[model samples]
Target: MELTLANVMGLVRQTFADPRGAAQVVLRLPMPLQARWAAVALMAVLSAVLMHLMSGLMPPAVGPDGQVLPAISPFFWAGMVGFGMVMTALLAFVVGRWRGGRGELADSVILVAWLQFIQLLIVVVQLVVLVALPVLAPIVEVGAVLIFLWLLVNFVAEMHGFRSLGMVFLGIVLTFVLAVFGMTILLMLIGVAP
Candidate 1:
């Protein structure tokens, strides 16, 4: 089915209420690879913009010279989002297949894209709260993280057609550990670590 405004709203509601049902809907859609990538790109750009705005609201870090340090570039935020989207799809596809899942890469990509869209909504709400009541920003940030984790576990399990949520959770934990290890190695190589 075409992703009209009404359909998208319905899907979002379903995702919030029953993520597995949303995953089923995602799997049934005939979205092209290009379209899927486009959606990912759109989410990445929006996320980057929101992050940039949110960062602007924070107090700038001061250096030893008493000058405000430059904030992170927008390009960096966009790149991070792009990298995260790709890695999530890759991990989901590889780990799911290794676990004897029947899902394909396209399924993983679609599910991740949908999840990112949901996350973008959460980010928007957090941004609004941060603007209105800065003191509540920390609470909103923590709540968003918890909500995202819960949605991700269910969405990953559903996308992979896995009957065991525990297996999916374990797979995610392994992926995260490996990613951290790899990033540490990269940082060391780049002299970013002492």
Candidate 2:
């Protein structure tokens, strides 16, 4: 594809019309490598700043070294959004690229943001659960997270018209299981996470 402003704008427009399909194209193909690097850098910078800000929001307790605890605030939420979108964008790219595609980066960002919006819906429900239905928090939160992850991954895959839903499902399940396994192994080695 010719790299022009029109093409970029078209990509953006096409992405909006059918984001999941457009995303699959971007994620799976061997597209221009520049966007990947750009995305990763953006993700890293945002992640670092957001992590710092979010950490400040935590309810602090006395440390073993006798330091005063910290407090968690509602600041830096946009940064937190940056952090989340970057993560989903990476996931979209990896899963998309793995199956062979050369899609645009902007589309990937859109998918990331769209999925993030869905997650926000879940968060709203979780918040309501906390306030009005405290006993349901764990169930709602965990179920919503798992369902959202699968749905987002699948939706992103569907966008690119590459990896099948089954493949995405297997990929996600395998990825999750392996992550757990790897963490378990590492923790076992270090005497953690039983």
Candidate 3:
């Protein structure tokens, strides 16, 4: 069956709301391979675009003519994709091993990349909503971090196994919270991101 854009968007929403369960859903589809392939492709494009947008939200780029422009740097984009791919593959191996999931490096790379795409989409939505109504900015940003941590926990389970999913979930929650604080401190020290 051909996957539609609407179906992909729904999966993206599901990924944010509940990633492990979402993974299960993806795994259970009648045509899991096709669905998975479509998801992986969509995610790659989304991550590329969203990474650029988020970078823009950070340090606003100034054009050579002194006009404000979106921060557009090939290095930054490369970092985004490279880091994402590496982490995804690593997590897939480690987590799949832990869970006895038999996830190959290539498989992990594909799934994790797609997962990041879902993650960036959520971030973009938060950024847009926060900018439109600044009062909710803090809530949205924190919420985005929580969702990521949740994904981390799910990825851990994907590798290790389901027995410790709850523990992994707790770990994700704590680590993510700590990461937020850690990242905030780093940003404050650096002046700002761009």
Candidate 4:
């Protein structure tokens, strides 16, 4: 595939039909490391811009304390997304290898970038649904989360050559729990604990 618009659209359809298969296609692409990283960075910036636009279109979100929260800047969202993409790839590479899986760092990077690309598409759909079909926004929100998790589990399993998505899901859960714990300790140490 030459990364043409039509090819990408076909891949997106295939992704919904078979996430692991789509991941295999993405992983096999002959993209260089620099190109992979650039793709991730570009997706992060695009996602941030879209998020800012979506926030502007939607009503203000009320905080738990009954105060309206300020909208996050696109720069901050971009930094967060970019960091998350890099860390997710690194974690998948390190943890999967530790679990006796066979996968390369480059594979992880490209797959993560591909996942981000799919997420951008979902965000666009969400934007449209929020405007034209407000009543179905909740369904779209739930569906988006489900689709994201499904793709993520399949992508990770495909990259690591894992046979059981159940185990992959468990690994993802554990990793997320540990990450949250570590971040909490770091925040506490820095006197920013909530």
- On the 0 to 100 scale, the lDDT of residue 53 in model 4 is 95
Query: Which order, best to worst by lDDT?
Result: 4, 1, 3, 2
lDDT for each residue of candidate 4 in 1-194, tens digit (9 for 90 to 100)? 79898999999999999998999899889989999999999999999999999999988999999999989999999999999999889988899999988989999999999899999999999999999998998899899988888888899999999999999999988997898799889999999946
Q: After superposition, how far is residue 27 of candidate 4 from its true place, in Å?
A: 1.0
* lDDT accuracy of residue 79 in candidate 2: 55
Using all chains and alpha carbons, the TM-scores for the candidates as numbered come to 0.92, 0.53, 0.61, 0.94
Rate residue 35 of model 3 by lDDT.
Answer: 54
Better-scoring candidate (TM-score), 1 or 2: 1
- Clashing residue pair totals per candidate (backbone < 3 A): 0, 20, 8, 0
Best by lDDT: 4
TM-score of predicted structure 3: 0.61
lDDT of 4 at 132: 98
lDDT values, one for every candidate: 0.86, 0.59, 0.64, 0.91
